[model samples]
Target: MSSMRLTGTPSWLNIKQRSARPGGGDDPSRGPQEPVRRVWAIGGGKGGIGKSFLAVNLATVAARAGWRVLLIDADLAGANLHTCLGVRGGNRVNLSDYLYDRVVDIDKAAIDTSVPGLRLIMGALDHTGMAETSRAQREHLFQALRKLPVDLVVFDLAAGADRATLDFFLETDEGVIIATPEPTSIENAYGFLRAAFYRRLARTMSTSPIRDLIREAMDRRNERGIRTPADLFKEIGQLDRGEEARFRQALEDFRPRLVVNQVRESEEIKLGFSMRSVCRKFFGINLEYLGYICFDDAVWRSIKERQPLVLAYPQSDAALYIRRIVHKMLGT
Candidate 1:
């Protein structure tokens, strides 16, 4: 956890950890994994929001951009990132293999895909509920992954704002939340931000007097006007003066990037602005709208052909949009 937050602004993505190899030299290639790691976890509030698609293209684009990329199919429920990258399951070892005893080291699960400089550590090959991972297992995974030799690690997380998902989202160097322009999708996205915001205070509130306010707020057991984070914090400042500042500082580390996908018109693209405004109002948070993606027919075609849009049709609208996002993420 000491290496969790890099700094303010884009310093979050500049995480670089160097450690002595087991043998003693500063050799970066001696370990089973990378010397340092930058994990970008892609998640959303609801399902079918193109999380995997965005993840695939980002990995492909970053790989083509000359960075060693490792894409993990962290979508434990339906781990299908391999299909997007066109990596067959016959010969490759997945996270299931590592978790089930086929491989002890997580790095050994990484395999080079068709995309140059890109590799994958796929999740449950059979998709038999890998989401039930214990926190200890996730911690172990994080520790092992942070030591990888790769430059970037992209985790395609599962849907919803569950604790497991939030933990993964928080642990990463960068967190990306994908949402469409639909009303339901937008509401879920807001719900996710609310959950993440409260989650930021959870560890502290569990013991502080803020715990009662949160519990009453959740159960409607109190009429303290704690409908929003701002209201709750106002109450907290009255209850424990210094804890309010501590709680605020805990939330400062959470800077999740937003992406409005499936946009058909320029008007729909502005949903990011509205969403960002809503996040600030409801959760007292600011979202970095990285960019938007147009809804492309070629996306479906790529899915049908089991090829990544960035590779199959580089000039396609979806491919270009994904490239822009990748560049923004890389700060290049």
Candidate 2:
């Protein structure tokens, strides 16, 4: 029998516990040595910014390039990613089934697409309640994604700044934020990043007195002029030197990449650079400008025909743009 020693400290202050990746070590599809997996979540501030379109075509292009990819339609309320991939009329296990426990395994629902190396775990748009996934379910699903055998996992997430949307955005290894040159889209894109930053900080410093300090900052944000990250950092350091390093580390690690879609002019392309600079100065979060895509009639034509753009028009300028984005994404 062992004597009970006094243990009165925050769990985080003690040894940090990492969540185990379920079945990730023995990936049956990839055999003994599993390849590295990359999970990319594509989201924008608004709809019609071409999040799903880019996601589907990128998956197709990557598959054509001889990489195994898995595309998940993360837009629970409006999951047309299956339609964009031309997956029609199949009674298959979807995200709903997995979430509701109709299926115990997530990989069991991965359906093969026309693209040889690409598989899809599709979502549902008809059941509006599907969007309200619990935090535990989301965490389990994310872990399940890591267990999949595919090299790349692309998530076409819903557009918004809601907790669900931002949760998916931050939960990924890296986030790909899509935005048009339009003013409203740009504004909302900033809004999304801002919310993500706060959410990250909130969760990171959740243990008091750091947690208590952050809560007070939130309550008195306007009164104390703690608007920018710089202001918050200064005040936090002044109050407690111990918490500053942790806060700085958390700030440095929240890097999100960007993509400008439907760019028609040089002026529009400059918006990406502008947004990057603004983020650095204001939020203190490093934003990588991945690249941009031009507006093309061929893309519209392909969409109207309900075909994957890269498959239908492989040599189109739009296809070349998609390839470039893929190269930069994989290179980074």
Candidate 3:
């Protein structure tokens, strides 16, 4: 059997074999600590592209592979990830509760799942005002997450490139942008990347005079007639070497990964590569291609059953596709 180390002890999950009172009281003997885990945020600009579906199944697959996984439903406004995981009870606390009430510690809100190696942190049901988290709140949430025990933490983010969404996306070690083969999905994905890049650059220059200059250069009405991020970077290179270096480093370090879903034909698969090219040429962004998932009836069936496809059909093409993605993400 495969086994992987986890980071922190989840409040919800109590591994039967691992839970023992050392002194037959509240105090317990100190033992070995789990290794810190990596956090990944899965998002897409447009809705209905299967972002939640992908996030749930991916976490399930990781759990099956013997890695303790914590799946966070970061989609505040329309948080349905609980339903996807077959959690049918009321949540005492959620992301909204933590955001709105400083007294509520987010760790107290985690929920155990039927799966052996997986746990879930539900998001806000009515997140109308909860999405407006200050920078301090965001940092607080991240700090709390760093203490969670899991080999992998996946955040199923809302579908958009709004300031809040972009902030959370940038906070994670890696972000996965899910897109379909459709034209609209592709266009929105590009727009999402542009917005994220600009937001990061704007934040990076919070106290610098070059911030205004960069903003003007990126503006559509500028004399340079720059419409794309590549054009803006080119203009910066001509003006100041320091600014150019900063811009280039941002572009290189902000390498977001891509996953093409619901693909059918070989031609449709080609769109993934074309997107990578367009991103490099027009946007000057290098995106890691994480592979594609073919349209499969079994996937829909698994969803209907409220189970992950990797568990329902381990040998199916869709499961294999997910395995490849995990491999790529792990660089194995």
Highest TM-score model number:
2
Residue range 84-125, candidate 3, lDDT tens digits: 778864745677767667437666777887777788888777
For every model in order, what is the number of clashing pairs? 3, 0, 2
The alpha-carbon deviation from the true structure for residue 307 of candidate 3, after best TM-score superposition, in angstroms, is 1.3
> Please, what is the whole-model Cα lDDT of each candidate in the order they appear?
0.76, 0.75, 0.73
Better of 1 and 3 by lDDT: 1
What's every prediction's RMSD, in angstroms?
7.7, 13.0, 9.3
Best by lDDT: 1
Q: Model 3, residue 201: displacement in angstroms?
A: 1.6
Pairs in steric clash, model 1 = 33-149, 34-148, 34-149
Question: Candidate 2 — which residues are off by over 4 angstroms?
Answer: 1-36, 129-131, 212-221
Residues 7-99 of candidate 2 have per-residue lDDT tens digits of 222122121122223123234454423643667889876889999999999888777766678888888778887787778835766887787
TM-score of each: 0.84, 0.85, 0.84
